[model samples]
Target chain A: MSIGKVGARKLMASFAIFLIATGFGMARYEIKDTPPNLSRFESTIASGGKTELSGIVVDEPDEREKNTRLIVETDNVKILVYAQHYPEFEYGDELSVSGKLKKPENFSGDFDWAGYLAKDDIYYEMLYPKINLVARGKGSWVKRQMFALKAKYLSALSKVIPEPYAAFMGGLTVGAKRAIGKNLLEDFRKTGIIHIVVLSGYNISLVADTVMRAVSFLPTVFATSLGVLGIILFAVMTGASATVVRASLMSLLVVLARTTGRVYEITWALFLTGFFMVLHNPKILRFDAGFQLSFLATFAIIFLAPRIEEKLHFIPKKFQFREIFSATLATQIFVLPLLLYKMGMFSVVSVPVNLLVLIFVPATMLFGFITGAVGMFSALLSVPLGWISFAFLRYELGVVETFAKLPFASFNVSNFPLWLTLAVYILYGFLIYKLNRRNTRKNQVA
Target chain B: MSQKRMAILLAGFIGGVLLRSFLNLGWAFAGFFVFYLSFR
Candidate 1:
């Protein structure tokens, strides 16, 4: 839809607000005055190099066990503690570490990873720190409970399914972890349908869309309100992650636009939510790869899905497969350039494989969620549902394996430059602007 | 493209994406063609 003068003005204002807020945030976090207690770390430990520091594990490891980054709190001074994946540390585990506290660094001719980390107010890194677990269960009660519940849910999936499939299901339900092994993950990466398992915005969108469709029969107002609330609740349940929040808000915008028929409302909704996310944690906009991809994918789907859907009348409307295919296509179109820019890989097999797998995602998630919830109560009931979920997971995994075996499945470019990515996006923006004008004219003439 | 021509072209494009993905020649062609049509 073409944004009117008023809508364009609103968008410009929102952009300005984002610019100001982000600028303020960058300064506030990066150079925000350090606490008095942290002066010891800055002067002696941070400057003098390797030292022994005892601290508590403030949160879960940053990544899958291998070379995980843990946030440690020692004497009101937080440090980025790195360790080899072992001894399985959890949130709230007290630890003593002896390591070099070096400053974060950036590689030349690449994205400034150090600047990205600085956005989180994290400046020091302790690589391969000597960690001695002093205690456990010292974290927040809510987070601990959430982790416990998540563990139990994943165990239920594992009980019903075999190795790699169970790992895939774990990813579909919870976020991607070490469940999928190194080989299978590489296969996933090569095939390029990894987002289904990455807990990315696409997965969140699937969840949101499922909720919206389930309640679509209600009155328009009620349906929109309920859908939005349900999505917010879902995000919170999924740890209220930046990625989840952005995806939910984007879906909520589409729901509101449907009920209100003010397409420009979407631009405002996107901007406002994105603004708040960056305002809450300015680092995510710059550093979080998932957040960047999620935002772009959601925007593309919102803008291009209807057009693709309009063009996709050939596919039978049964099972909403056409709708799913259009969405998957639209999102892939939007994300492909970014993915190439970042990962430098193009999967010829991506679209078809995604279509084969994504068609089953909603059903798989439904059965998987039901199995997890029910397994918490009645094992007998959940077992049958678990098997059903396992079957779907197996089919998707099979697609990945089969496609990944092809040498021509994917081709890698050596560091697709940032400049090319930017230029491509600029051209894409112009194309979309022209299409919007054309569509608006068509609507007017009609 | 006229309305009828656009309809036929769009159908061909979708077919290429779904059916000709084996070699990907048609799929790649369809993608660029769709980009052309989207902005034309």
Candidate 2:
């Protein structure tokens, strides 16, 4: 009646497969069932007149250069409002908004603006809305406090660091709501280093590594506990958005694996995390590009980076250059096809630009955190650290700007087929299989 | 299962999801059926 090890393994694998299959099935069913009903809004929007609605701001105000985007919810429907930056809004402010309510429209490119918003159940938008704050503090107490703390952190960063650099530092440390300017954002896109600015798993992983090393003098259990606590605090500090939560969970698994010396177990944990995320929000599997890229980049870092490092004999190991190089290469390779398909832009100089910038990221983040923390208390005391952080930020911006201006820096691939993207990934899977088989055979011989 | 089979299985599951995303539900079901047959 007892099952052998192979039998047990098979049973576990079968269970995993069943669970994943169910998840996929559920996602497909949800997508098929829940089409957005815009009939109610459409009738009002088609009137071509100003509509007045009162609602509570449901999410953080997305601060851009000239305007701030807010999601206002009343009853069951949520509307995206673009309000002037002068009268800034907080997360939980109740407001009466008057504007021309219109359905989200697609831009010139292949971007499906409506479909993208549909993932979040947002169908209508108010452009340049006349918003009056009716009340404040309508959201969860914890979120309001988190947003206030984030605002104070950004204000502290600005006291010491100049514009653009201050904004960039804010992005690196706290996922600041402020924009880093459209031109600079385009440069980041062209150079393919945009992930650095966003609160991605890569950034969280770096933070986790820094925490682990900082507390390495302590016992393994204590250090791991501290590292996890730091990650949780970080997630909470950043408003615990879905993206940050996912990154924190992935980083947490990685820290646990390193501390427990259980690398294989971490792989299952990683997959389970992904499975649960998809199960919770089936729309993200198809609609959310950030979700897709986060998982793919993490997977490449975990599995492909080491294999790539073995072949990168020419790269020096000093300063962890080889490790960074392998990681950058693996992630770029793994995510490229999807990126090309989703955003028809491809950066030819992404590798060189990444190498030039990534080496300073860890140090920049360290000094940047110090600058903000100290600046909060005394701006004068933080100036020295702020200057050091600014130098790194300036260099990174210079590299991105210089490389982005090159004639062959990037190219546009219009209408990339989905089948081709799938084909590329399948080829990748085949190559990985061959590589794993060869490694196993070599181990047997050894 | 062998590593190759495992990779194929994983790819098949992903392919089902991708097909469901890009195409219709029917294609996704068909994609899963093909992989199920192959695995068998």
lDDT, candidates in the order shown: 0.73, 0.81
Q: How would you encode candidate 2's per-residue C-alpha lDDT over A1-446 as one tens digit per residue?
A: 45698888876677456546544654654564365565767778778746898999988889888888999987568899998887878889999998899888898667778877877778789999888999999978877877787788789889988999999988887877678999999999999998888777767767777877898899988988998988887787776656677778877887877877876465566666766676566567788888888888877887788899999999999999999899899999999999999998899999889999999988898899888889889999999988998999999999999999998999999899988998998898788778878887988999
Runs of candidate 1 exceeding 4 Å displacement = A1-39, A45-48, A62-68, A75-77, A84-86, A105-111, A208-239, A251-264, A378-381, B1-40
Error of 2 at A387 (Å): 0.9
Which residue pairs in candidate 2 collide? none
Residue A263 shift from truth in candidate 1, angstroms: 9.0
- Candidate 2 C-alpha error for residue A377, in Å: 0.5
lDDT of 1 by residue, A161-257 (tens): 6777777887886664644778888889898877767687767878888889999999888888899887876665466567778877777778877
Task: Tell me which residue pairs clash in candidate 1.
Answer: none
Instruction: List runs of model 2 lying over 4 Å from the truth.
Output: A1-24, A27-50, A212-229, A239-243, A255-264, B1-20, B23-40
A407 Cα displacement, candidate 1 (Å): 1.6
Angstrom error of the Cα, residue B13, model 2: value is 7.0
